[model samples]
Target: MTRKPALAVVGATGAVGAVMLQILSQHADVWGDIRLVASRRSAGRKLAVRGEETEVVALSEDALTGVDVALFLVPDEVSARWAPIAAAKGAVVVDNSAAFRMDPEVPLVVPEVNPHAVRVRPRGIVASPHCTTLAMLPAVGALHAEFGLRELVVSSYQAVSGAGRDAVALLRAQLSVVAGTELGAGPGDVRRAVGDDLGPFAAPLALNVVPWSGTLEEGGWSSEELGLRAETRKILGLPGLRVAATFVRVPVITTHSLAVHARFENEVTVERAHEILATSPGVVLYDDPEAGDFPTPADVVGTDPTWVGRVRRAPDDECALDLFVCGDNLRKGAALNSAQIAEAVALEIGPGAGDRRGLGSGQGPGSA
Candidate 1:
């Protein structure tokens, strides 16, 4: 009998990790003996997966024993230190962190857009793009395929959950302080009310949107804005694609939204673009403003597909289109992408791996 791959879900107690557990239960049964791994602090906690409660073991060399695939939903620093170790131990690591996305050898993949890239992982690690980039790329990639992408102008309205639990709590607390009040109507009113507890944001997130969401970069760009530009290029295989982006933190809970102005090589129209998106894999076209229908974060928070709406050809340019896309940051943006990559690796290794146990026998996808 062909043996199903054994899997490890690292950071099993994290926000994205929790969502990953839900995804595992809902996805096709392709794994055997699923192991949950977390920090020493989160160890011993029982988490449910595949209709069974599994105790999380502390992340260590032994925790990854005989694992065929490791889905890393941890922080950048943590992933940096551990993903290679997991990879070296024969597990193909699908990391959901900034640690490896830009690595020349690690494939930054969006399954719907760049599934082929997953097979060339020289480092035995696959990278998921930033949640902000994941929010819009499925639709964007569809449009680019038909029209030939030229440039992108994007502005992201990112939800707080992408910043982690503390940011979510900060936004909720600030909402309570400013609710039913004229706090945003006056200057410094909302700021004073929210006080100094920004919690990963540069400005108050109660009634206002902060123009920044990541560490500052050269030329005054934020890490997120630059990440959007870089990851989009890598995933789309467009190294020189012109992209300008601004990332903003909004008072939402779960989904990330993007307003994209995409310039293509050939002429584009709303009718054709609609047809393309409506049929694209992992994408939903919900563009009907007259009927009060358009993709919004509130409506897209829990959904798995990228919801694209308000799609229009630029009024002044036949080669450009404007779109608003929303995606649950924790799902497709993070956990779902990692899960998909791991699945791809499983399929690549096939069901006849025998005692090799996935990529650990010195036969990683990169050698494929």
Candidate 2:
């Protein structure tokens, strides 16, 4: 309680990890000793934090000792393996991967929506929702609080940077190759014209939109679509909520936007929804189609708040409304969310943190 707690950032060399470092720098000083941690390949590399070049350490039992909080920004598989290890070493882990988002014990948290959930980490771990699920929380969550959301039809326009750093490179090269020729006129245009380096995406991403994001799952829906549905239901505490999503990858480099049609249990109008959103935290209302005042990835990239606009009532459904939302995928969608959760943990349990429960004293993940 008397001292700032030590913090560790796992996956310090990755995309989200880099953003996590930037966010921590921008936030109020809430940590004691900040350590940069990554895989063996990244270990020993230096990254500046608060004007100091911190050496990166490999993820291991020794690297995580005495950490009050371990903010994970690694891949799902890496987080699945190392997050528990970090927690066991006495750090309250706030994971930014999908590995534990749906876990019964791991709290899926977005501080603006459900901050109290951060205090009860049954596994000594808190999970951040997928980037797509998180992108809509502030705006949609504020509306749900007012109108009692019951159904959602969401379509996401995601950016390529969400895939990783290499995908960003591929997109830039493909754009140059297809500058004027109908821009991805046909399939394999990226591969035939540019090199065959589309990264993990299912289709070419030059000027074309890929209707798929994650792998295909049951009922012919892609896993990303299912992720949006499941994470929304979990975060909003509406287990039986009717939610369907279609995720499409766009050529943008950062920020993900969504077109949301939400039906509520009570009557709603665009005017009332705009009033609620304008006064809410972490939401920026920019709807004014007449003046062309709306938000795009260009408008919200590198920002933390969820930028919402185009508020209107559905023509046929009086109980329904429509809106557009945008958020920086790497910031609020991943790194910033975890950082906020960590700050909540610090405030709740103090510098001593969960030591009373065998966490703050550098104990292993108990029954984790």
Candidate 3:
């Protein structure tokens, strides 16, 4: 009988972590024994896995021992600290945070775009791209193959869930306040209107749009915007690519959508762009504008694949193509993508890939 590799999931109690568990359960026939790990506060909590209830354990160095692969869906700081420890213990770590994405040694991967990069990871750590970038990678990669991409101008309509669980709660509470006020009460009578301010976000997200996601960096761009620029260049193998982004958080529950305007090195007609996207792996083109067929957040909330629609050519620039794409930020954007990276590493190291090593030894391709 063939032995399935043992796997561990860090942050196994949070939003993306829960989705990771669900995806793993759905694919149980392929996975081995699964272990759940989280912060100390969430330890000893029971979570369902493959029809059995499992306890979530606190993440520690000892928990990583004997594990074949560790999937991290925790905060950046937690990942920055624990990922190295997990890698040192001989487990391939597929991190779903921004901790090491742009590191020279670490590879920021979207499997459909750059699977080969996963193989050369010397750090034994593979980083998943930002949720926003993952939503658009397959589409951009397809276009790049057909007509070399030169520049990209993207505007992301991100969901509140991207900010974490607290942000989701804030949105819900704010909505309640707004609803109460609309029912014959004055604006100041609502909890939110009278400064029951829980600042999980900069502004009220219940019925409003905030033009920022991450905090602003040196260049006046939010960290979320910078992530798009960096991750896109890394995945597309265009280190010097010209890319600009504007990321905004919307009130939607899940899924992220992008409005991408791309200019190619050579001329790319709208017809040809649509044809390439139609056959692209992990992409569904729905470009019948006249028929009101287009991708929307509602249509993609729980979907794994990125949906593409509204394909058109820029009126002034024939070489530029504009498209709208959407995908579930929690699934493909985080959990599923991290799991796919782990699977790719397992394939590279053979079925029995449970060899453990000390911290200072057993270095791989992108090791520190």
**Candidate 2 per-residue lDDT over residues 18-127, each given as its tens digit:** 99888888888877789898999989999988778999998888888777788988889988998887877667899998899999888899899988777777788999
Deviation from native of the Cα of residue 3 in model 1, angstroms: 1.5
Per-residue lDDT tens digits for candidate 3, residues 229-335, read 98889889898999999988888989999999999989888888888898987888888989999999998888888899989889999789999999899988999
Tally clashing residue pairs in candidate 3: 8
Report the Cα lDDT for residue 54, model 1: 98
Order of the predicted models by TM-score, top scorer first: 1, 2, 3
Model 2 pairs in collision = 88-364, 88-365
Error of 3 at 333 (Å): 1.0
- What's the residue-level lDDT of 296 in candidate 1? 88
Per-residue error at 4 for model 2, in Å? Answer: 1.0
- Give stretches of model 1 more than 4 Å off: 358-368
Q: Write the per-residue lDDT of candidate 1 for residues 146-165, one digit (tens) a residue.
A: 99999999998989998888
Best of the two (1, 2) by TM-score: 1
**Candidate 3 lowest-lDDT run of ten:** 352-361
Question: Which residue pairs of candidate 3 clash?
Answer: 121-365, 121-366, 122-364, 122-365, 122-366, 122-367, 123-366, 123-367
**Which lDDT values do the candidates have, in the order given?**
0.90, 0.86, 0.83
**TM-score against truth, every candidate:** 0.97, 0.94, 0.92
lDDT winner, 1 or 2? 1
